[model samples]
Target: MKQDQDNCDFIIQAGHDIYYTHKNVLSAGCDYFEAMLKYDTKESREGKVVFKDVDSECVKNCIDFIYSGEIEIPNEKMNDLLYAAIMMQLEDVKQAVSDILKRSITVENYFSTRKVADIYGLDAVSTRCRVFFSKNLMKISMQPGFGNIEKTDILNFVKSEKSGLYEEAKLTLSLRWVENNRKNEEHLHKCLEVIKFDKMSPAFLEHLLESNLIISNDFGLYKLFNGHLLKASKRLGKAKGEIDNRDFIILFDADTDCIRSLDPIAEKVEKFHDEKFKHLRDFGTISLDSYIYVPCENKSVHRLDCRSKNSKWEKMKDMICDHGEFPRSVSWSGLIFVIGGSCHKATNDVETFTYSLNQWSQLQNKPTAICDASLVSLDDSIYCIGGIGQDGVEVSSFCRFIPFSAEWVDLEPMRYPVSDMGVVAVDQKIFVLGGCSGGIEVNYVSCYDVISAQWTSLSSMIACRSFVSAHHMGNWIYAVAYGKVSNVIEKYDFSKDKWIIVKPEVDQCFTIYESTFVKL
Candidate 1:
């Protein structure tokens, strides 16, 4: 026994043996002790446990068990090792044994066994295990207790069978916490907590009504149950005021041949939002040949008017300096900046028309001339993205126009070149949606980040459209009409990151050339 101990110590000191064994062990079971002893042997024990027979291999194995509390086992010998670890109640060894089994198990089989492993408090082992366990898991529709789980997570959970959740996660996840877990009757009774309603969906309002938590006295007006009518009524109203006293200007393309009245259109808008229209009585409209600006009293929109076609020509020449035609896509920064359009029979000349002192003045030319592109004003700067060029080819280059310095700087291009696309500014971010690229209508939505100077693709819209018109209202971006004739209006909510299909209350026959939204 003394010679055997010396041999074991010699193997450990040689670094070949990395484990150790204990002497005078507890008499829990001989099977465990025998397995532990075998675990300590580097060679096949052959059911022998005598000190005289223990060679260098046995000394190495004993040293391995002493230091690491683990013995490397072959694939074929894992089952026996697991059984021994379980019998010995060695949690760390059992976990190691489970890990070995998991590494070999197929993804499909791993899922099924993971649950069994989890139930036994072996979550650490089970978590590292991945299996196609979802296939065998039964799918059940259970309303998620709406206690603050993220919508994306809920949606993913509901779509997977791993959880016995429902497929309506998109619908239920957007609800408030009080509405989700209705079992807490006391919490539900605290309904008078008059919170400001920033986003109000028709479906959400309907859900509240169906749940008996709210009642509507009139269409589009909602009141919470056991709450004051005044507070509920105020919360449900839309259009607060005329954007304070600041001059709110609207820019629109009047499509040369279209016959439309700016005031009646404004009045019609007021009728749809009766509660908010009361404050718009002081608003005015300025109509140009094909462009109109609301609160027409704004001096910026008036300065661009050229009086006659020849005067417009002289104005164009004086403003552009290169004697080019007007650009189809225009953006306002106190003055109008025009880029590549039909110049001298489809010429590419980027020019700026300054509105200060009521005169057209030229600015720095664009790096590349583009037409039918989407233009947006964000943070006192203008961005031009994706359009057809003078060569009748589509381009995706992005350019910025600085008003104060009168300079043009090139920026990173878009992922796709889209012409005749609708662009809208929402929350200081520009969204370019639905346009003709590669001679085909595209439904891809791209968002440009001013801060990061990067472009990210968003969820595609329901329909493919080009020449679309987009308007931003609060957290929603409403896109309406495209192609030959479309009455479809799609509303995209950034908060929910979901699209809502809505029918505009206005007449369907009227073609909307340019519509402005005023949050009254």
Candidate 2:
């Protein structure tokens, strides 16, 4: 039976609204109400309570939950309900509200929810938000509310192992945040302390010094970043933060089904991810984040997680059309583009795959039906370099592809006709290394400047062999001649136009035929 307002002994006033209830009903569920009603307080003698800090709707919901043991918790009123439950000492109601808030937390509402959790000292909610924040740091950092996050939370995220940010990225993000608040020099210093300055490369540190954000507004960081650059260049032995800071040249030999790791800085090669797989001939590989995608000639794609210790080749969605053998691939905007390869004969088939959706779709064919071409992504478009054209001849053909518009525009041809060459892009320039110019192997090297729209011939490699694989790391371009049994590895310094031999320093040599080399 419903009690009339006149018969109710307790009166609760929330803002302009009044809630009529009984002492027995209020005290049975709320400790705060029971203590007030039992004690000699003025509110107890008058049998009334006035709440100015809580919302009227939240107060009504809490009281309704007390009488009926159930209430609907709306998303918009979640924070108010939680605060009201806390004020009334409703343990069960508070727990239910907290669970609902945690369940509904997302990248968009994380900052607001975190503020509420911090206000109430909600450790569980705070911890869950931290975990969620770390996973989506890249995405959340771009949000408008990210700049308003507290300095302490930013530092904690910088220290998290799974933040998915490299040392350079972390430094840039911290500096960017500090740039927003120049008066907080103390906070900026604290943020700089947690970063592993030794892990940053000299080039990145120098680039940081050139940043107007640091040089113009914050001269103190300029000096600190400069000092770190000096220290980083002279630091002996391997750098710290091995998980996120280190870069390796991943060499996968499809013919022998063997994978090897080459530490570019140390010039050392080891079998770190040497797991053997079924023979994958003429497969193409591309590196994205921590995973490597291998599009096989068997029309299937496999992924390898570099972060996993027991990482095995995981099969992903198969291709919509048979990419066939010698398909060149590049990743842009989180999508994989597989260019022309050989089918019955040379085909200009093109396909794209989305890793998240686990689906593949066909794209417009290339202008020229080419196979064994070198594809590199830079700026916002992909460039397809030298390969064997439809006439079954080595070509100097060069073209630019815009994935956003699915448009292909022909650019200036290479300086020399080559196929199965080592090609890599760095600093808005593409370097083409040793490959076959005709039936005979050539050690010719060329550079194509995207900004200048011109080509320049550079110093040739020491080893004159075909089937070359190239990777760029830091300031060096490594070209591996895998056609011969020697497996000659040479690195080029574009600034000096010089090439030097790099020994593998491994116990066993790799049988590197039709291999893909990627920097991770």
Candidate 3:
């Protein structure tokens, strides 16, 4: 066999044999049908002619079609070429013939082309052929057989100018089908499979409260799909022992500046929750004085002892580095880790004040300089959420600090960049709320799922707020004192997933900046 580079022609040489290629021996155009008889034995012609001889020009055309895998047949010869290509299993030639038929088919020839493509098992070509014949093709196209078109092919056709079938095709495909093709389809399905019931049954609402899916807004209501209203209700009527006992700790910024200023706001907190605290005296600024202190300013975290009367607040004998800024955001385990704050122009350095050693020590530095970011402890790790960086630039990305290893790992950035946001860890998930760095204040809430390493958008708060503080109690997360000198308080119910308004009894305006919460 001799192959032609530029044309679909092959020259075959057999010893003392001359025959022409054709589809069948008796085909009308195959004049070279007798050529095969000269080379074959008499017995070969006795049964049936599998091959036939055609006109010389037609033979050359077919040969060229076979070699090149493409042939531009005129409108009149299109049917003949298609039949020949299909018989010879010339896939490319068959496709080319289909393309021609698709572009030139009229009502008169539509059925014919459809029948030919269907017989040849060319589904794509058959669809195109059927579309040409039927005026209401979209209505019939969804009927079983057409559902198998490759998604990529459908998308491509929709993108093409010649194909005005996007709307029709889109109607046939459901959102579920589109979702099924996603790379994270299994994960999405798993999330949807878990049913959350509103009425209390065998499952506890606390389980839903623990879910990262529940969101609470500024209005103090937990929110689910379509803003399902959630209200605070004591666990009753079912398995009462399953309810867990957890206390609420309100964080207040009690730095020397806030305390010494003789602000009426500090007086109000002491008066309101006096019964809940064992000791209310200023514990001095633990963070700023030790880790985030400036050269001359006295910034410290006041330790408000909340334990029982017999239990005294143990001083983690930790000494501040000489001239080092006091720690702003501190987390306690074996030691206290303080993140970024203004020491000398807002240092991004991280330091640990070991409760055992009672001395502040330097740890790894953050990738970016930040201050006023919210820090929360979850799964024995400390996470620093949105804050303002150098030049007052707001950042949404977060970094985690591991106490055992003393390493910091970066996590996914938040959907919105904000500073002075309030964050609380509940059920191994991080709930971040109101904060602002630039002129824009954000009320949108977001939750970070630790296991999945993904973020989900939650309902927005009723009021835009900044510099908020959050406290988690039972299955509820409360956001208090957002914005400058505001007494706005909201509670989020994790069970029904809704926010409800709550009144915080406080007199005078105060900003809760870099505050810490301890469960009472």
After superposition on all C-alphas, the RMSD of every candidate to the true structure, in Å, is 20.7, 12.7, 21.7
Q: How many steric clashes does model 1 contain?
A: 17
Global lDDT of each model?
0.45, 0.73, 0.48
Ranking by lDDT: 2, 3, 1
Q: What TM-score does each of the candidates earn?
A: 0.40, 0.53, 0.42
| Off by more than 4 A, model 3 | 1-246, 251-302, 308-327, 342-344, 482-486, 504-516
Q: Pick the candidate with the highest TM-score.
A: 2
- Distance (Å) between predicted and true CA of 386, model 1? 0.9
Compose the digit string of candidate 3's lDDT tens values, residues 445-486. 899999999999877767777667676765677776533324
Could you say which candidate leads in lDDT?
2
**Which stretches of candidate 2 lie above 4 Å from their native place?**
1-245, 253-257, 342-344, 483-486, 514-520
Model 3, residue 215: displacement in angstroms? Answer: 30
Angstrom error at residue 70, model 1: 99
How do these models rank on TM-score, best leading?
Answer: 2, 3, 1
Candidate 2 C-alpha lDDT tens digits along 1-520? 1235877898899999888898887787778888999888999899888999899999888889989999878888888888898888888887887887788787668888899998987888888898887666544543446667688878886786666667756765565565445554467777778888887656456544643344545667677777887886565224443333367777665445667777878777676565675555557677764577878788888887765447778889888766577567876544578888743246688877655446576766787788777788775578888887778888889999865456799999987788777788887788888878876889988888888999998888887967677887788888876643245778888679898888767666566554444432
Show the lowest summed lDDT stretch of 10 residues, model 3.
Answer: 288-297
